[model samples]
Target: MTEERNSLKEFFNYLRHHDLKMETVPLKEQKDYQHPDDDVDFHAYRILLLIFICGILKPTFFDNFTIYGRGKFSFYDFLIRYPFYLEKALRIKNKEDKIKDLEIKHYETEEAFSPMIRYIRGPWDHKYPDILNYMVSKNLITVHYSYFNKSQKAFCITLTDLGLETAQKIQTEEPIWTKRMEAINAIFRKDAQNQTIEMFVREHFSTLILGNAGE
Candidate 1:
């Protein structure tokens, strides 16, 4: 068990450094870091997805923790809210007031890594496929192509066994994360309607991300 803990520690360190370090390594050896087909960095993907999953799996009552894609199997909800929630969960100040916490990313390499645009630059950024696709391909999640309101809402998503297992790690290993979930769940419990979650998100996150949008 002690050896395994040490290995996990090393892996986390590798994630923080390896990708950027790859760019600086000898030009002749850069190819070693490149995968044959996948362009997405699985290392960084893990970190980003961890945050995404934490948001998806965050606090809710009766354990109803699913993201609906508004009549399609899309990343709409996750893209718009997860980043905002995760940073605050980490107690990271969100200077962008955006769903994408661009303010937290401070490196040149991180700029190209926007799964979604850092802000409402335009409609195009919102239309781009969300990084959630990577999880789908990895069997971490599955998108259901059915509608709840008779095609009014076409898509939704749920975490797979793999996804749940991954979440268990964070929930067990990170105390703050456990508390964040508890906090979000508490917010939901206090609201009688429970349907006005967007309103609640706006109340807590709007001012930080939007100058006056929440107003």
Candidate 2:
């Protein structure tokens, strides 16, 4: 743990060299940093969060997040797995029903899945499915599934084995930076629309895990 702490300190030192205005240690005890419930939300990706926050501050950013996001690898991962939007029309009369059925059978036999998917955003949540599919196609995740919604659009999902393995490897075998990266990505995926979380991270965090985001 001491080695981990020192590495984090050095990461901040490097960031300072890069001209980022991150404040250093303050006159506070470790207890002060801990919440009563030990539950403090953290923010690790400012640029990515900006993708959604730009929306709240400026609507044009929201459209860009969806439209321009089409080209982003993350977004493409969300697209490929389940619905295959390019082939959507001829696919199925009740896609949701079909996917849920598959999920049940898939879960029954599969013992493990890529943990990375769980560490990141989601299986499918309207806009997220597209990004999730992109991750799968890139082999960043193992599987993805989608079901129909009120608009007859796909809504549900299933993840693949590779996804779980990635998550497990990061959470266990990788160094602290990798673990924190996983944690950070997890936070952003949970909510990109809020900047309040980012503010808190900026104010409270004196260190950041700088190891590879994931390796």
Candidate 3:
């Protein structure tokens, strides 16, 4: 029994030191990390569908005096950040069983690598500007810019006829994606109607938007 115990201790010592000291190599830095949703075509198609479902307007345009005066899904501010919010919404495990399939597996994977970084206003993705530019080059959408205030400029994005047609086809062909868009739209509409968008963001996205305020 003493010999057996000594053998076990020796085995554990081997595991704790020499066995664990097998050659180590430094991990190579990935200079350009690519996310699955980094595909411009994919984002363009999704944004087209979103604009079709929600319509066009500057997201920052809000009237404080009137209650629920703006059109539904017209806020471009929310549209710009929609992908991040959509991913968050889809990742909720407690959602109804009917929409359980909307939980995209890859979104979680993408978040693992290239999670949204907080910006001045909210969470910002690096791919949005490129996707918008690609859409414009393809004539999928049109942008109109105007001055919102003395120092600020506002832009409204609308789909071209081609964009509209393409968005329609996507809506018809991708039923699951269409449902996801509807769910996101409903969430935004509820927040907008209740004038609780700020509160909702604070509650749901506090980590991303509020956690790093000091930094």
The prediction achieving the highest TM-score against the true structure is 3
Write model 1 residue lDDT over 83-164, tens digit each, in one string: 3444453343322232232333344223323443233211113432444566677766665654334324334455667766
Q: Name model 1 segments beyond 4 Å from true.
A: 1-25, 30-65, 69-128, 145-155, 189-195, 201-214
Worst 10 residues of 3 by lDDT: 63-72
Worst 10 residues of 2 by lDDT: 38-47
| Residues 1-215, model 3: lDDT tens digits | 99999999988899798657545454674356666577678668767887776553434642111112122222223423444455555445233443454555555433433344555435556666687788889988866554433554444456777887898999898776676666665555533432254445555566555355432
TM-score for every candidate vs. truth?
0.41, 0.21, 0.53
Maximum-lDDT candidate: 3
Q: lDDT of candidate 3 vs native? A: 0.55
Candidate 2 global CA lDDT score: 0.31
Ranking by lDDT: 3, 1, 2
Clashing pairs in 3: 59-75, 59-76, 59-77
Estimate every model's Cα lDDT from 0 to 1: 0.41, 0.31, 0.55
Report the Cα lDDT for residue 203, model 2. 34
Error in Å for residue 1 of model 1: 57
RMSD, each candidate, Å?
Answer: 15.2, 21.4, 11.1
